[model samples]
Target: MKSIAVKNIKGRPARSVILVVISMLLTFAIFGGTMVISSLDSGLSALENRLGADIMVVPFEATTQKKFDDIVLQNAPGYFYMDNARVQQVLEREGIAQASEQFFLASASASCCSVAVQIIGYDPETDFTITPWIKKSYSDSLGELDVVVGNDLNAFVGDTISFYGVDCKVAAKLDKTGTGFDTAVFTTKDTIKRLIQSSVDLGMNIFGKVDPENTVSCIMINAAAGFTPEEVVNDINLHVKNVKAIQSKELISGVSDSLGGVSGIIRVLICAVWILGVVILLLAFTMSVNERRKEFAVLRVAGAARSRLAGIVLGEALMICIIGSILGVLLGFAVILPFNGVIEQALGLPFLLPGAGRCAGYALASLLLCTLSGTLAAAVSALRISRIDTGVILRGDN
Candidate 1:
């Protein structure tokens, strides 16, 4: 009986083609939106993990006026060297957990094969953010005039490069972080000082290459468990005059803000697509229900209970929802497969394989929602058939 009902449902134009299209559209919109948001969030999470620093302490003058801009916009404007003693002072504070200092150096044609590479110099013993990841790849301790390159630095592991006339060995390659770290190289504080010493003839116009007397470009602070980043920033501001502390979230928000109108437009477009998909689905369900009233009324006359008639209608809707959702998922994956490189290039980040369990849950939940919505809409028309006078339905007056 169910087979005959399914076949009859399929034979009707409203149940066959339009229903499938609606399911395809609804699934595509929902899943596609999910993928895009997940991509953005994953990229952001990767970046935050790489930074690892809870608070960023830059020059006191730079923090008040757009913190990130002051640090990265132009080296000269953002450049202010706080006393290494002051860095230690912040460390000694009660709420402070740990701190590591780093300086950014930009090198052009550091080697014949590699182009410009940004170098971040850290004190190995004090630096905690990236050392763990780097140590995992290369067990050897980083030495003076030795460095590890980022995955996207356009150089390979074990390569050698000359920086400020000092030869440095590329000990290992860091993991792909999908952030600025991908374009940076890491080295020890001693190596950075030696490079600055070797570049005495450059006359102080360099982006990095600081004197040995100075400790670092910025101090990374990790607050104790009970302490909040904002409270620490406020404390630092009150006690320390020449240093600025920035929270990690503020830093990310700053970066997102710099993305300008493009991100906003993308969000708006995603919303519009969602609305259109829902409208298509509602229209498809309503039309299918309208065209099936006569058939449903006949089922009612043949001693089929109203519940049974409703079930047949709902079963057809479920079939359309399930088939359309599966096809949409497959199609969405196909679209994502070819665009891996494009996504990486556009975001300066690579995508991760979504968790199989999570994706399965998404698919199952989406189909359930779609099927339920269709069933409810069809149920209304089914109930209307139940309201018909039995004598009239028998007399073919549906």
Candidate 2:
């Protein structure tokens, strides 16, 4: 039976190839669209985990709200400072479990640093955010003049990075967060203080006189259990001065809204492609079976059962679907893995590919769906042919 199905497929090379190519295209659309959406979802979740803060307190006089939003959501780098006193005040607020001050310093140019990147300074003693993430790579505290570069940065551990004549060793490298952290550099408060002083002494004070000891770029806060982020934000706004408290969810909401539109478009496209593929395959099978009526009649006269005739038709479609889906899945991975960086830049969204096991599972599911659709498209033609009168077909009647 399988041999007969193979012979039938081989008899019409052009039609068979066309059906296979169509199946491949349909599979590609399904797999590619699904993987991209999955990656985006995973990336956003990772960014939330990396932040692990209920609210971010930036100076009230800092850049406009729009610019600040771009910094956190779009990974745009910028620097501003406010009095460190705000950090202490935020900590003393009701429902605040922990708060840490962070300092920001931007390298003037590539000449001033290994790369043009934002420098973030954190207090290890009070930090509850970056420290825990960094501990995954390095357990010890970041010593004086030691830094941890972001995953996107070119520097690696043990490499020395210079900023305005102040050299700091890269003690560790952080994992990618698909956010500004990927392009920023992190170090202890003492290291940033030295960098600021060095810039002043060397007459390269591009950021003006930065009093590292009394200035802070932002404060990260974690709320106590049973206290919501909105409540924490409201409490901070009421009691804290010269700073703005932004909830993490507030920042993520805008991005999520934008993603909703993109996801909708992708789903529509997937559905359209699937429908078109099924229609075309059904027509192809119907035409092919019409031309093979005499052949099916001959087989039936030779003692071949009607069920066997139907199975042969389905077997041909199954073969094409299996081969096409495998090729399509490989093509999807080829395009997605190599050009992921380009895709992320073009989309301007967080993206994290699924691991090997999950990707394999997705591929298997796609293959099964494609095969089922292909088989169903051929089923009507198969059934019609199986019920044809053997005598009329053998007589060459219309």
Candidate 3:
């Protein structure tokens, strides 16, 4: 019976190809859309956990042209300076529990590659934000000239990265954080100071005679018990001079909103494709069955049962769905896995693909859905073909 179904499909190559293409499109829509949505959702969650701060404080100039937002959310390389003393001032404000200062510098080319990345200098003793991830890979104190690279960076522990002729040894590499910051290079305040001095010596004019030791780039603060991040931010903005303070959520809101929009569009496209594919497939099967009425009647006269006729119709659909599903899934994997970075850059959102188990689940789910849609679309035609007036179709009677 299956062989007969296969023979029937091979008998008409064009119609079979069209049906297979429809099934392929259906599977591709489901798998591709779900993968994108899943990656964005997971990436945002990781960024939230990695931030671990209530408020961010930076020199008011960093807010100019949305420079700071670009630096934090998109990892666009730029830097501004504020007096390091502001860290203590912010920490002393009411509703502030703890604060740590960080310094920033931009390298046009990290020694290992020509890609630009941010160099962040954090206080080793007072920091809360960068420490959690750092401890996962390294526990020893970061010596001067020792640096920790983010997971997205090409450098590994034991590799040396140079900045403006200053070489810093990579002491550790932090795990993936699923944010643009993953490309940043982290180091002690002393190490970044050295890099700053090196750039100054090379006449790079990055600092313009500003004393590097007395300046830090930004501050990350945690609000005290019973104090919200909003309260802390407001207090700092009101009390501090020449610096801007903002709640952490404000920095992430843009990403959240973008993710929501992208995910919505993907889902809509998936639904639209699924509906259209089913309609086209149903029409194709019905028209093909109609064109083969006399062929079915001849087989019935040769002792084929009605159930056997229906099975052949469904079997052809099942074969198309299985082949199409395999092809679609392979195509999805080829594009999504290799080009995830390009997708992230294009969408301007961090993207971290789901783990192995989740990917397998999605693949299996899409395959099953494609198969169900195929068989169901053919069902109506199968029923009609099985119940035909074979005597009329065969005997040449009106």
Identify the runs in model 1 with alpha carbons over 4 angstroms from their true place. 5-15, 42-44, 61-95, 109-113, 135-140, 143-146, 149-178, 192-209, 212-215, 224-241, 253-279, 297-305, 336-357, 385-398
| lDDT per model vs. reference | 0.66, 0.82, 0.85
- Model 2: lDDT equals 0.82
Ranking by lDDT: 3, 2, 1
Best by TM-score: 2
Residues 305-371 of candidate 1: C-alpha lDDT, one tens digit per residue? 8778766766776777677777777776777546754765675433433556766676666666655
- lDDT (10s digit) by residue, model 3, range 243-328: 89988788889888989999999999999998998898899899989888899998899988999899989999899889988777
Error of 1 at 302 (Å): 6.2
What RMSD value applies to candidate 1? 5.2
Report the number of backbone clashes for model 2: 0
- What clash count does candidate 3 reach? 0
| Residue 388 accuracy (lDDT) in model 3 | 85
In candidate 1, position 195 carries an lDDT of 58
